[model samples]
Target: AKQIDDLTLAIIICLSRLFLHISADSKYYQSFFWIAMSLLQIHDTKLFASCVHFLDQIVHSMSDNGCFRGQGLATFCASARKGPSERMLAKLDQLSGLSFKYDFSFAVAGHLLKGLKNVGTKAAVTRLLNTFVEYSQENNPANVTGYFAAILPHCGDNLSESCRQRLLSCSETGSSVFNAGMVPDKIRASLLFTYLVTILKSSESEHEQLYIYKALEEGAHFMPDCLPVTFDVLMKKMEQILVASQNDQMLTAVLAIMNCVYTYGLESSSPVATLNKQYMESIGFASLGSADQFNQNQKGALIQAVCRVLDGFLQL
Candidate 1:
């Protein structure tokens, strides 16, 4: 005989409250919360629907207040381990629309795009990228730049390359539709630097090499200030790889550095070009017999390697 259980219903309600509490603070807990939420849906459809209703109310309330103050809501939405449903996405979109108009934080939108990426939605990522580009150009806000920077790493290789080129073009014009504040430029530069590093670290095919070369060239030409920092990071990684005689990794890193320098120097009047020359001169390669003979030889070798990389840039 099937028995009705009022106590079971009460227990389910209590569990839902507890799950929401934890999910609000720790992104890690949201995975378990979602799993529990899914199980509840399967066993008690009413409870599952109720949970969704609660989420909708929370989102609306946050939008209205112009403050998404619920830690649990943000954590749950940002959990990379969860697969958000159509209903969930609709709610997120609503929240994003509200955020765009009033909050301007775009925090919800960024999380929704991240959710789509975690679920491996290529189409969603493409749509997000396109929307970001449009918003950045139209609004020229710091939040827009941050959102794009956050999503850039999740995009597939081809899409990343396309977006990167757009960013480079924007930076070159100095008419960046985004803010020119140090924080915004730094975020954008960091994304480019990280992308280039990833390409150098993982690329093994000729096609990948070509794409990486293109990315490096664009980065060097657009963000000269980032070169020294990028070089430092790459050199450290290369040293680690060289210790193990990982010839492939070493070669890739070296080539990427050279390509970046040459392309950056391609414009004779560009700051990067001047910096490259200055770097060579600092190493005592600008004049013969200008320093200790041993120092001269070592500096000359460094300059030669740089020149080799620059050669590739000139052909572009």
Candidate 2:
């Protein structure tokens, strides 16, 4: 064990020195980075701190040198998308420090997203996403939570139902882990909103949306700033229901989500709330134009759901 510790420490020191000395564009940078990432597989406080610093440096380098907009970014982004090894994920889970954790996870997530934009194949993207879910399933779900938080808001459109549920489970686990710590209120609020937005975007089933609504109710102390985003996303989902497959359960789920949002956030007369109210009413009326497509019972249910949401807003 002592020999292993000494070896790990030695590698950490060597990688620290290499990162300090190398330019972001240097040919050796990628090789050194992979070596450093592999070293994270070893358990050592000093090594983990060094790895976190290395992650931070990668972000700084990107900002300091716009030149990474080309090959340099692609290389690092690809590496990040592939993610760290399994043992490394275990090591990451055991370590703790909010800022460092955020930096480490966010850095990798940012890279993965940057690389995703350039990928030509949908299969490749799905493979990358599968890797993330597998990581959560095989290890501590919170180990790479920042990645999920970042991905949910941007990559949700392509998620399969099973994948979405697994991701939601991971987010729930991560939320508990974060809540146990001294995480900032704003960060917690934002994270909740992030999950909410993703669910609103991709959730096709009433069961899934109900899960999201319950989550919102549990974490309802979100900041007022969440109003606009919640309103916009809910409105978009509402519009999608009106124009596309007007699934009654989905429409009911949207109304439930709106109830939670309005009940906990925004003032009674907030212009944003009023505008959403009006928009929803207009959407309901517009849907009536296609009344020929629906039976009397379906139309009645639809109108009742809209009226319920509008009444909730009115009482507020």
Best model number under TM-score: 2
Sequence-dependent TM-score of model 1: 0.31
- lDDT string, candidate 1, 194-289, tens digits: 434433443344444444444444455567555553453445544554565445744664566566666566323333434533543333222111
Segments of candidate 2 deviating more than 4 angstroms? 1-107, 110-120, 129-143, 149-185, 195-229, 239-245, 265-316
Give residue 145's error in model 2 in angstroms. 2.3
TM-score, candidate 2, is 0.36
| Clash-forming residue pairs, model 2 | none
* True lDDT of residue 275, candidate 2: 58
| Residue-by-residue lDDT tens digits, candidate 2, 195-276 | 3544445555555454554444444443545444355455666567656755676556556556665776553434364554
